[model samples]
Target chain A: MRARLILWGIAALLLIALPPLATALGQPYYVDLARRILILAIAAISLNLILGYGGLVSFGHAAYLGIGAYAVGILGFYGIANGWIHLLVAIGASALVAAAIGAVSIRASGIYFIMITLAFTQMLYYLGISLDVYGGDDGMRLKSRSQFAGLVDLRDPVAFYYVALGVMLLFVFLTYRIVNSRFGMALRAAKSNEARSRAIGFPPYPYRLAAFIIAGAMCGVAGALYANHTGYITPGLMAWHQSGEMMFMVILGGMASTAGPVLGTFALLLVEEVLKGWTEHWQVILGPLLVLSVVFFRRGLAGIFFKPDA
Target chain B: MALLFEQLLNGLQYGVMLFLMAAGLTLVFGIMNLVNLAHGSLYMVGAYLAVTATQWTGNYLLGVALGLAGTLVVGMAVEVIALRTLYERDHLDQVLATFGLILFFNELIAIVWGRAPLYSSLPPWLQGHIKLFAGSTYPVYRAAVIVVGLLVAALLWYVVTRTRLGMLIRAGASNRTMVGALGVNIKLLYTVVFGCGAALAGLAGLMAGPIYAVQPGMGELILIQVFVVIVIGGIGSIRGALVGAIIVGVVDTLGRAFLKPLLGTMIPPTAAEAAGPALASMLIYLLMAVVLAVKPAGLFANR
Candidate 1:
């Protein structure tokens, strides 16, 4: 456990030092890439809350990402670029939607759960494409980055990078706490054995639903950061494959482990970048890589650090 | 009134297409308990193969036949090479593995066929319109698609109900371990079932080529709706897939066609115009959610 903490600490320090190191190396493009990866790590970590720990395999988590992004884009469209408002609206809307979706989705389990979540996200994707006023299928560009009342200038790349890094760290810490809490224990119990959990007097429904909503809301914050990171929002962001990619990150980094998804995000994206650099048909290679990883790396990258369970 | 009638027919045609895709998916899900996201990729493969074959032979019908056979072989191969191991794994593994297949197939198609979308032209015999009633006409090709889809569904029904293989499939779905103990070649059965599912998806794909864009990721566009159909109709039941597919197809089509006009009458035209498309697109999802809320196992859950 101490070794794990030390490894995580070193990882965190490296993340903190990324911007300066990348800039000094004259590969400043990597800072921007690192920011995107950090934002996505937040998304992946949130997914880990439900998928890794709670055992709710939601295939539509990208809906929250899309919603969060659209919140910023639409708000910016109407000239409301206040960062606080963007964050609030993103979280609130995603939470409400998640609550509604979770309420219905939790009634089902296994494959049904995965499909229903995917269906809802598809519904949202269709809605996004139909919003003609908001650029519809083609998507819209954010007019400007969310304003922070002059507290932090987002226009500065370094400032924005630190902001993203800070938020990601905060979420990593937050997820760690949640997963170790009493509520987390209840959720995990229900995940392992719903009937047994119920017999033990903790019904899985409410806990599962709560975790589902919390995961969605947390992902919403990532979406807000993602929109600023890219300066664009589209229905494509909520595409099923985007959700699939996020799930892969969670699984690849190591499910149920707080730091695992962050690691997975970094690993998957970095590999993708390298492959893209090598050839245009990168997904052809990446696709098989994902398959092989899933088949062979049953425990994922983080599993290397831990002893096998009996 | 005639326009509404024609639109309803269009919905039926669309529903028939969805049924073709949904039937195979439901069968695989029921019998194998495998969630094949890459099923869409098979549909895509069928379309790509058929289009290329048609160009080679100058015979659309022959091209489709070759495409169908090719997809069946590919499907069986996939089952053997990739999906065979996944049968015992968790659904998460199945999902991610198939997702990997999707990426591979889409990119592979792009590499082979170029990223530009291809157009599949209807043969001379399949063109023109059929008069339904006074002042109403529907395209003959669409009418044929409906007929073909229904025939396949009927054939599927007959096979599932009357045939020995159908009995085994039903037996397997209900009790896989028991079937294996009973000396059935379970592995071969899974491969055949997967292949049949692939052929169905391929049929849907090849037929859809002319109507929709024959592009790399075209399968995904319809795949999600097929999931909705499967969900609404209960996962394992063929009847449920047909019913769910038709309902979704009709609701989606009618909503898109008339929602703006319907909403315009009750509200400002501009407001209706803005909200109509969005609401129409979301109509089926709302339906699915309602169904889920009321019957989480779906309307016709097999077990």
Candidate 2:
């Protein structure tokens, strides 16, 4: 517990101090990297809610990202410039989509659930491409960063970074709370053994569905932030591969805990960037790296760091 | 009416192709209880190898035979090297490891094949169109695909029911530990089953190279469809795969062929035009969602 607390303290300090450290080092690019980490961490953190805690390995979690992003992009296309409106639309649209998908998909368990979630995600992805009005197979681009009406200017990179950081921290805290609450217990119990959990009279459906919604809503926020971060939206955001990458993050972070997602995101994305810089065909290296990670470190880096023996 | 028949044939051809892929997948799942996400990667490799082999050897059939062998070898190798360790692990672990393999294969293909969609052509005998009825024709290769798919399906059914190897495979699928305890070489049986499945997937890819773009990540595009077939069909049952594949193929093809006209009558032409293709692509997944909703274990799930 003390080690976990220390690890959390160190992570908090590193993230908070990253921008200044990067600025002092004259590598503002690192801040952008940090921004990516925080944004992706938010997505992974939300995924951890379903996958790590609820034992629901959704192979299409990135669909919520697509939904959240498209909500912003569609609104922006119509000239709805408010950031808050983007958040509201992003959250509401993603939740609605999640609810619909979860309502259908929750019927299937294990691999079926994975495939069903993936199918819905691909459907959304194809829908994104078929949207010839937006950009079709290419992708849609935003004209400007979301406007905030003098409250929180998202146009500034650092300001947006801070906002993303704030949102990520909020989600992390929220997940911590959810994972510890009675709902979290029920969700975990259902994950460990469904029939027994049901026999014990704690029906797992509502809890799983509720966790799915929260995770989807959280990822929706990340999606909205991602649109603002990249100043673009594309069908690629909702691709099943992207969902797999997020899954890698959650698993690498150590799925059962909140801090694992943060650690895993930082490691995986940073390793990705480093590899891309070193070689053009980085995935060749990253792929084996991922295999090795899973093979050797099943509990993940956070799992290792937090182990009492270590 | 003739066009509808052609569309139906197209759906049948597509469905058969899905069966070849899903047959192997379902077998692997049924027998090993492993979710090989990289099953698609093997398909992609088959296409790449076929293109390369065809270019190297002037004969297309020889190239295809070689390609299938190569793909089988690679699949067995993957099982031995990477997936062998994962059988004892949980499904999530299998998923992650195979997911890693997908990235590996895609990038490896890009490096080796230079990222271009390899051009492939059907043999002269397979290239011509076959006239079905008055003024209606379908590609001979597609017809061949349908025929081959049916033959393979029948062969699979025979092997699974008649052959001793098939008995072992069936036993393994039904009860792994029991089969292992019964003194059968479970590991060899697994390798053979996995190789056979890989060859089927390879055949699907090699055949597809002539029809679809033979490119990196091509496997992933069709893989989702195969997954849906398994879901709608039932994961472990080959009969379920056959039914699900045909249903998905027919539904998807018919939806694309007929949906626009039907929707145009109900909605505006522009709206129908815009929504048509998207809805067509979504048709199979929608079928899968509906099927899973109605029967979560699928239509023909073994257990």
Best by TM-score: 1
TM-score of chain B of 1: 0.99
- Clash pairs for candidate 1: none
For model 1, residues B1-303, the per-residue Cα lDDT tens digits are 998988898899999989999999989989999999999999999999999999999999999999999999999999998889888899999999999999999999999999999999889989999888896888999999999999999999999999999999999999999999999999999999999999999999999999898999999989999999999999989999999999999999999999999999999999998999899999999999988888888899876
Q: Candidate 2 — which residues are off by over 4 angstroms? A: A1-3, A307-310
Per-residue lDDT tens digits for candidate 2, residues B1-303, read 988899999999999999999999999999999999999999999988988898899889899999999999999999999998888888888888898999999999999988878889877899889888797899999999999999999999999999999999999988889999999999999999999999999999998988889898999988999999999989899999999999988998899899999999999999999988888878888888777778888999887
Against the true structure, what is every candidate's RMSD?
A: 1.2, 1.6
> At residue A178, what lDDT does model 2 achieve?
83
lDDT of 2 by residue, A1-310 (tens): 6866787778788778888888899999988889988999999999999998888889999999888888889899999988889899999999989999999888778888888888899999999999999888888898767888877888777787788888888888898888888888889899889899999999999999988998899999999989888888999999988999999998898887768888899999999999999999999999988998889987887777665111
User: Which has the greatest lDDT?
Assistant: 1
lDDT of 1 at B245: 94
Q: What's model 1's lDDT at A218?
A: 95
**In candidate 2, what fraction of native interface contacts survive?**
0.76
Candidate 1 lDDT over A58-172, as tens digits, reads: 9999999999999999999999989999999999999999999999998899999999999999999999999988999999999999999868978788899999988998998
True contacts kept of 1: 0.83
